[model samples]
Target chain A: MAQPLKFYFDFLNQSSRALYIFLEASKIPFEAIPISMLKGEHLTGEFRDKVNRFRKLPAITDHGYQLSENVAIFRHLAREKLVPEHWYPRRQLGRSRIDEYLAWQQTNMDVACTDYFQQKWLVPYLQKTRPAENAVNVAGKQLEHTLNDFEQLFLNSRKFMMGDNISFADLSAICEIDQPKSIGYNAFQNRNKLARWYEAVRDELGPYYKDVHGEFEAKLKQSGSSNQGVAQALKQ
Target chain B: MAQPLKFYFDFLNQSSRALYIFLEASKIPFEAIPISMLKGEHLTGEFRDKVNRFRKLPAITDHGYQLSENVAIFRHLAREKLVPEHWYPRRQLGRSRIDEYLAWQQTNMDVACTDYFQQKWLVPYLQKTRPAENAVNVAGKQLEHTLNDFEQLFLNSRKFMMGDNISFADLSAICEIDQPKSIGYNAFQNRNKLARWYEAVRDELGPYYKDVHGEFEAKLKQSGSSNQGVAQALKQ
Candidate 1:
């Protein structure tokens, strides 16, 4: 028997959750190796030297080849694995469209969302202190601008990003939004089109979205409670 | 015959120059429509409404379908046009590796280069003032860190990024580095491996690199002389 693909992930990371759901939904067999970002497992030791030189979460070692970067890994799976066509459809230049969105998300949406997540949760969690009011506000403002742009540019009177089918663009985007959303950011306020599209993608993915999102929420709650404890102690 | 793949680009933009070279080198027929980023042509009016809704440079319209983002356009060309196999070779999972590099570049290298360029040249050029000393220093420090990271993470003993053959990653990266290099930044300082890799890519590319780079240099000189004038006026 051939060796299964080795996936190193942490659900607290958005790309990790996105790819995890992708692997599960696609029914690709793989060994799940969870690496905690909180513990700095991905930053040093074996994970750094042996697995991924980039030291990023949600890396994969397929057979003997190592690959990092979420979008790259997603494309690799689409090409090398038995992924269905709908996720990265070839009909009517769908792949190009998806590619465009992915590129935009990498630069714009992902940056904004990740910055917001880092300021609001990750930094506070790591430092055992309250979120920096000014930094969080700045990140929030950027996130607001990005979400508005996302809705205006990508969202429309469609069930998903690429019309009817839920592509990886939608999957990746929802997970990105969740990074801010799970930490108490209201993304859907005054944005009905975005809300409808989000609901559609959520409905389409069903259990795959629910299970991974549940794990993410659980992790966030655990962190949140501990953070509150720290806040209380700081108050004293 | 097929509308010649209308490519809206500004040579001043790195991706534009990269894709222009790719289109030329690959012999894919494209109608080169230059939109000046300096004049804010890509930001408003028909270019924004009819061409690209995103208001970004290095955009394309192929057979009536629009596409944006350099990496996406490269992939689209590879898929839809008669691009050479070596540019995005499939053997030995070369495409995956290139994809990884491109993703990393979009987030890190491209960001640093653009920021540095903006601080060092574009911002001051547009505002008709000298470069902000503090901002330039910050951006320069970032560029230095990113250059080191790029050299360590991507460059190896290979003749190119994907070994022996010049891939799009090398092409794109060289153009990105030129964004800082053209504007008087010493990218080759103490980085022997990066310098060698750059020379190899430039040599392989031959005139495709030369013609575009010359035009870029010419534009830089024009803007640079005007910037000097502004400085001289301020001195008086």
Candidate 2:
């Protein structure tokens, strides 16, 4: 029998969540392995050599082939699995729209969310230091700007990013947007368009939704007190 | 009769340079339209509303279909043109490596190069102020670190980023590295492995290489103290 593909991720990461959900949705048999950023497991030389040299998450190794970068992972898997056109889009134009979303989000929502993540929660948890008021303010404003762009520039009133269809773009954006929830601020709270789109994404994801994101969120909640919380979660 | 695709780019942007070269190499018929960043052409209502909502490039329009982001543009073109498998591998693993290179560069060489571009040239050109010594030093160091990673982690003496045959990854990286040349620096000057690989990429691009890049290099040379030079080139 063929070896089950290995997925290495930490729930603290939005990209990892996106990939986790995508792999489960694709129905390809695989074992999901959580690498703890809290433990700095990803910083190990062995992980660098054997896994991703970039030492980033949402990466996979299948039958000895190692790959990293969430967008690449999504594209590779979508093409390889030959999933429905609605899922990833088969025609050149349709797929290009998905591509625009994936790439655009990098400097937009992803940057804002990560900055906000480090400021509002991760720094306090990991560094045991309070996030500076100025830093927090800056990050929050940046995130707001990004969220506005997400709704105005990309998500809009559409049920999905590529319209009516829940493609890889929808999965990727929702994962990034959900990052701000750690601060008890929901990006979808005021934006009806985005809120509706988020619900649609959750529905399309079905039962696989929680497994991909829930464990990570659970781990994040416990991470504040000690690194032990993350370590313990990894073991389970 | 079918309408030929429109390729929108500004040579000042490295990703645009990559797509310009790739489109030519793919043997697809296209009308290359240059958008002037210095003149704020990309910020205009018509460009933003019609071309790309994100208002970044290199974007494309085929008949009525519109798209933005170079990676998507390259992937879509490669698939639609049915280019040789070596240009864009048919198998998942082969394509994943290429994907890894393309995506890895985003956080790696791409970031560093863009920072360097802003510090060494763009800021100085647009702002009419000399780059801060401290800022330039920091940006240059970041670029050096990224180049080292590009060589050790990805390139490693391979004839191409995906090994041997050229792919979109090679085009993307070379275009980015070329940005430093506007400031009179060659990234490959000290790296033997990278220099050879760069030459191999240029060779593979064939006669099409100069047309995509040469015009941009020429434009950069004229943009220094005289916006008139750029205007003259545009008029031509």
Candidate 3:
């Protein structure tokens, strides 16, 4: 008679998609509650006061213990669930490496991807306006620099970020890249190593990646007029 | 004999001070190798290529396996070394709470403090110029907003972040706040809760806090003319 793990998320978010895939792939039993970020569902009323105090997407209540932040929720599940070792392998100090990347991503990759997504897509959709050319260009440049750093620092000749296996770092990074990628950003251009690694992660993730990413794409397309406006604006 | 743990750090950095205190308090045997960030020691030569490929401060090498990033090094120590259980307790899901704070700190608290520090102190020092009023004001506003968020979201009517005992979250956060504090930012202006929590953490840490913080202060003093210039510029 214990309360089930309740996951409240919006697929528009990169962390949300990554965690959704993680939950489904790991087969952790939980209630999936979709919160519409665009509608301000997470900001107003009950969800803010009672569910997540931070009022952020990609949150969960595990047996009444409310938790926010993507990395925190991921760690909580890894500790309290039957997560496969491959996701957070301890062999050869894999967990430490993942921890390092996650920390770095929080400061670097997450910032760049989220900023690009905002300028290219989210801010425009929210404001009912076209993407600001200058802002998008600035974000694009930053994203390019960050992707280069990501390749130089994390990715090498390995099939994935953590070698032959796909860890949460790969999952997290792929979803982060998709934030900009799905918004008409060319993340893989001129970065052959990153492109190959992306494919490898996608292939490894298979259906889970496809489904969540499909939902994300659908959500993007659902913002139909916004996308069209950006396309036309950029064209002009 | 096993190779003693090697810690490369500069006390001027917040995380470096935090980890240095942790090592001393925990009685962990480590070879403290100071890398001067002001001198660009972490950026060039052997430290960049051989020590940490990421070329960051507060790095560690345990049995020749190099690790970078503050939170990663903390977790690595917790897992591999005899860090006190109180630092990362398991009872009442303290670890999860700590993890949440750490993640939040990385994105929120750490960013605001570091940004404020850079704007108010580091940038001026590096460029041999007075602190830019506009940039410092912007960073000050951000730091103020972030401090407010920190109080509302994290601190409560408890002795510490996790109630009663000091965790790594408190340690990490206190150090982060000090970055701006050491540079003359008035962090405890309005938030009584944060002020109380800050005092509690400081009192709890006692001499260990004093020593590391003293070294940090000394580093600031050693910067000499940079501080004098900022003081004069702000007055004008």
Candidate 4:
């Protein structure tokens, strides 16, 4: 038997949740090794040595071979047929679009949404303190700009970013967008196409979303965090 | 005869320069289409529709096939043997490491460095006014952190990021580091290993760097920008 693939990530990370949903939806057998960034577990020397010395989470150790980066992991998993063939695109232009989305999202949507979550939810709820008001406002502005860009570039014409079929680009964007919703931002609620796409993603992921997101909600509730609206629904 | 490959970019961009240098060094036939971000060329509808409908640059059109993202372009070019075999590892693990570096750099080093360049140089220079002194100072601090991480994670152990061979990671990094140097920031000067590695990259590219960089520097000077030291050097 192949040594079990081990995924290392915190439950709260949007990228980690995206990967988690992918694995769960694919029905891949894997062991979860949670590395709590909040608890400083990733900073430990042992974890550093065993995993990437850089101490970045959302890494994976597959059959003793360690790999990092969501794009690489997604590509490996997709290559193994965990994702639909259309998701990874064999055509050069299609593949380039996927690469373009992935590259653009890292600094654009991902960073903006992550900053929003860190300020509005994580820092206040997890760290038990409020971030500076200006920081929060800046994050909100960034999030708005990112969503507008997404609306213009992605949701305008195609049913998905690439086409009618949902790809990793959709998955990546949906997970990050979900962050603000969990904090009661509701930015996507008014956007019809985006909202429809989110539902489709949730339906496809199904119980897997419950498993990854369910546990995350429980943690947030137990901490008595104010950002519990999304979590409360997940419990049911 | 094949229509020459059309490369679109702001020549001052490090990632763009890397591709330009690679194509030049390999003696690949291509036409340079400069996208002057300083003049808002990238945001224009004509450029957006042709290269990337999403309004991103550093894109390429080859045989009417349009593509974006530096990694995809690099891979495409490398597949054509414009890059050494070792630049993109063929074996599974080796290739994954390259992917890891490529992916991580986008979010970490690349973003950090670009942010610094924008805040420190571009915004003040192009806008023809200085930003807040505190903002520039903060950007400088963040850049220092990023450089320190680069030295620790990438430069410490291996001859290259992957070990014992020059790869695209080195090329990517050298281009970015060269930016600050162009503007009179000599972060690599005192760092012996980094300096040596940069020299190797410079030697590898040779006169190709001169042609692309020489034109880029001239354009910057012609723009009458007082903030760019690199442009000043080229003018002299």
Candidate 5:
């Protein structure tokens, strides 16, 4: 009997969703455990001390071997020969192409998305203060620039980020790119190629796509904001 | 004879220096080319239309093959089997351990250093504005938190970042961690574990250390400000 991989996830986080979709798609033996970032379970002693010290979400323990970071998890799975090589690519050039996107996105696209969320909700929801207009405007511009780069630099008419095949890079891109939607900003509004790529990924992920993002939409509808879980920090 | 690897570098950027030093240490056949950011060469048409579209430094050209981003470069070289296995590690687990650092640092340590530099120099040197007090304070706290994580989470008394032997992770960590020193911030001050790790990396890299970093020291000595060339944006 193979030991099941234990996945710790927070549904509110797109990083978590990306990994969850990836794990589910891999069809590997695993247990999915939801840890709420909104409720602040991530900071508790059990998670912080016993699991990930950095305390970010979407961590995995495969038969007592633990790993975090979406990129590392995908690579680890590939290295363990658990998932298809296409997800991470075994070829040097293919993996390098994916690596460039992985490295560039955290500092560029992800930061843009994070800043947008921070400006939109972090201040208003958490501090009970009006969102800084300048910060919101600045962050919005950054997000736009990142999206533009996504179109011009990576996507650029390719069926996927690394070309015809879908890798974890595409999975990561789709998840994070969907993040601004919590505040109702759809990156695909006017962009053609990006919109096409977004759809292709969704179609490929199948019903799991709806399961991951639709739940967020439902949460957004019910709660009126994705920032509420983090909002409690104001009292603390 | 094999074609030489073309390195496009700007001594102003420590990410460039890390790859530069690692390649030197690897004893790989390569040519080091400095593309001056000072003269606005990177933004020029030939450099952009033909080379890096993003116009960031630390790019490589090997036999007409083009690649950028420091991590991708290391992986490319390792895949080519040009460097020692220990630097990148052939084993999956070891590489995954290193990859975690590679992804984590860009967002944490690197951002902290960047923020501290911006606070200390960017606003005043070019913008003619007083440094933003809140921005500087925020950046300082972020740097402090990241440094704490570096010690408690990553290093944790290890000989190197990943394990006993030095890897590109150490080089990457050392280069970015040392950046603020150009502006006279010794992160090693008052820290024991990190200071020891800093010294260990310095001792290991040895003379090439002086060459890559000494240029920045010289630049700092001659210029007296860490953010001069970057300051030209204020004029624009």
Candidate 6:
């Protein structure tokens, strides 16, 4: 008998949450092995032997094959039709649009938003020191630029990045964008279309969203501290 | 009749060189349309409307399907055996390794090497004021770190990134690393193994490498400037 497909994830991570939501929504069977980065479990030697050079979480192993990186995993899963086919279209132009979004997001949304999360929550918590206002301002500016681009290019004409249906692109975006809200930015407050789209994504994700993201949100609130809380607590 | 596969390329680009070489070697017919970034051809309204939001070059159009980004195009073309089937293995581990290299390279080698190329060659030609030395130093450090990681992780044991055979991984690496050398860095001088691999890549590519890259190199030399030479020489 083949080993059950296993996903190594930490609920705290937005990337992992996106994949977890994806798998749950599609009703794919996989055992979840939680490797909490917050607890420094991911850096252990035993974990290192399993994952090798990657210090990041949210890896997947199936039939003894290990894979990392969210977009690649998302692509592999998307190929399995756990998500909408239009999420990674087979045609040239359609596929390129998806590819463009994936590539662009790494430097744009992923980097900027992650930086903001770290600055707003993680930095003050871990360092027990307030980050320079300029650092926070820089991250805020980057977030604004990315959000503006997302609105003008992606959310403007279509219901989703690719088209009318929800996609991994939308899921990926929502996960990162929502990070700010958890830390207190309220990204969807002023943007009506973005807010509507977020609701649609949450609706489509259904119970899967509740199961994975709900638990994580509970923990986040329980901590009563943003990344800063965790950081500051560690110092104490 | 279907429109012949049309490639918008500047041979100086690693991704374009890889694609052009692959197409030529495989005897897949493609029309090469040079879009010189140095001459600002890529920023033109005509190019923008046609290619859509992407500002980058090395885009391809096949029967009305337009695509940009090398990895996306490489994946599409590699499917047709312009390269090896194992270049993007369908299995989880094999595909992940390839995907890892592809994903890792974008922000790593691709961005770093491109910055180096621009600073070494393009900035002087294109920008009125040269970029600061510290900026150049930072870019150089990034390139070195990426190369070191490539050597330590991928190249240490395997003849290729996926092991024992050429794949798109080699193609992608060769293209970017070749950029610094073209601009007079002699990047492979101290790196004999990497040099040998590059030679092998060139040999594997055969006449196809010469036809596409050779033509572009000749044009670059003849013009002494970058895009100005290409634009002046090639009308359409």
- Tens digit of per-residue lDDT, candidate 5, span B22-127: 8888887787778877567888998887667778788887777677777777788787746877787856478878888888887788889877877765445545
Question: For residues B57-131, could you state the per-residue lDDT of candidate 4 as single tens digits?
Answer: 688888777777788788677654455577777665666777777887887777777777676567767666654
The TM-score of candidate 3 is 0.96
Candidate 1: segments with Cα more than 4 A from true spot:
A229-236, B229-236
Write candidate 6's Cα lDDT for A1-236 as tens digits: 44356788887788889888878766677888888776788899987677635666778876666677787777766665455565566653566567767777776788888888777666665565665567778888888888877776678655666777777778788888877666667676567888877788788777777677778777666554555554343232
Second chain TM-score, each model: 0.95, 0.89, 0.95, 0.84, 0.87, 0.82
**Model 1 lDDT, residue A89, Cα:** 97
Clashing pairs in 4: none
- Better candidate number, 1 or 2, judged by DockQ: 1
Shares of reference contacts reproduced by the candidates, in order, are: 0.80, 0.66, 0.76, 0.58, 0.62, 0.36
Candidate that scores best on DockQ: 1
Cα lDDT tens digits, model 4, A1-236, are 55468889887788898898877766678888888887889889988888767687788888877778888888767654355666666564666677777887887888888898777666766655655578778998999888878776667555667776667777788788877766667677557877776787677657877777777666656654444532432232
Q: Candidate 2 lDDT, tens digit per residue, B1-236?
A: 54468888988899988887776666678888889988988888998999877677778887757787787788778766656677677654678788878778776778899998787777767766666567778988998888888888877656777766777777788888888755666676688888888888888887777786788777777786464422332332
**Candidate 3 Cα misplacement greater than 4 A, ranges:** A1-3, A231-236, B1-3, B225-227, B231-236
Residue by residue across B1-236, what tens digits does model 1's lDDT show?
A: 55659999888899999999999999988898988899888998898788898999999998878888889999999999999999999999999999999999998999999998888788888888878889989999999999999999999998998988999999999999999888778899999999999999999999999999999888877777778733432232
lDDT of 4 at B206: 71
lDDT for residue A197 in candidate 4, whole number 0-100: 69
Clashing pairs in 3: none
> Which digits, one per residue and each the tens of the lDDT, describe model 3 over residues A1-236?
54479999999999999999999999998899999999999998799887999989989998889999899899899999999999999999999999999999999999999999888777877777888889999999999999999999999988998889999999999999988888677788889999999999999999999999998887777675556665553333
After superposition, which runs of candidate 2 have C-alpha atoms over 4 Å from their true positions?
Answer: A82-85, A227-236, B227-236
Interface RMSD of each: 0.5, 1.3, 0.7, 1.9, 1.1, 2.0
Quality of candidate 4's docking, in CAPRI categories?
medium
